[model samples]
Target: MQELAEVRLTAWVHGHVQGVGFRWWTRSRALELGLTGYAANKPDGRVEVVAQGPRAACEKLLELLQSGNTPGRVDNVVAEFSEPGDALSGFVER
Candidate 1:
């Protein structure tokens, strides 16, 4: 079978994402989707997630990020697509 082309999604999630275990939730979600990337908190009270994997998986991740499982409310998820960097090995919370 032909290998699927990799893609990247850089997402910024807003709304109570900083203190509601959003990072952990993101990491778990990404791992379950077989994605590689990092999730971290921004000083401006947002959660930043970078996911690299198949295009479909990355899109799924964006959906998950928008519907966050954390106790914090998910106000929005702004995602940008780009060529995969091929730099991540596994999902992690940064």
Candidate 2:
């Protein structure tokens, strides 16, 4: 038998993410999915989200992030998949 591997999803959400409650929404979704990581705003006018956990959960979160939660107008989602850093205790908004 084989076990599923952990994954990390790093995403940069563009368009109306800042000042629109994106970070808090991200933290809520991530926590619901049982992912551990953080969400923060970049000076470049994007929202950075890092989620580490089961691959399926991470993928689902990615989809939600791209779907533009309430109060956010997500125009584009630039995402990347990589190995988890294994350093997150819980989902947070930074």
- TM-scores of the candidates in the order shown: 0.90, 0.92
Number of residue pairs clashing in candidate 2, backbone atoms closer than 3 angstroms, sequence gap of 3 or more or interchain: 0
Candidate 1 local distance difference test against the native: 0.85
Candidate 1 residue lDDT tens string, 1-94: 2236788999998898887778888898889999999998888998899999888888888877766566589898889989988689898887
Cα lDDT computed for each candidate against the true fold: 0.85, 0.88
What is the lDDT, from 0 to 100, of the residue 70 in candidate 2?
Answer: 46
Worst 10 residues of 2 by lDDT: 1-10
Worst 10 residues of 1 by lDDT: 1-10
Best by lDDT: 2
lDDT of 2 at 62: 88
Query: Model 2: runs farther than 4 Å from truth?
Result: 1-3
Summarize candidate 2's per-residue lDDT along 13-79 as a digit string, tens digits. Answer: 8898899788998899899999999998999999999999988889999899876554669999999
Q: What does candidate 2 score in Cα RMSD to the true structure?
A: 1.8
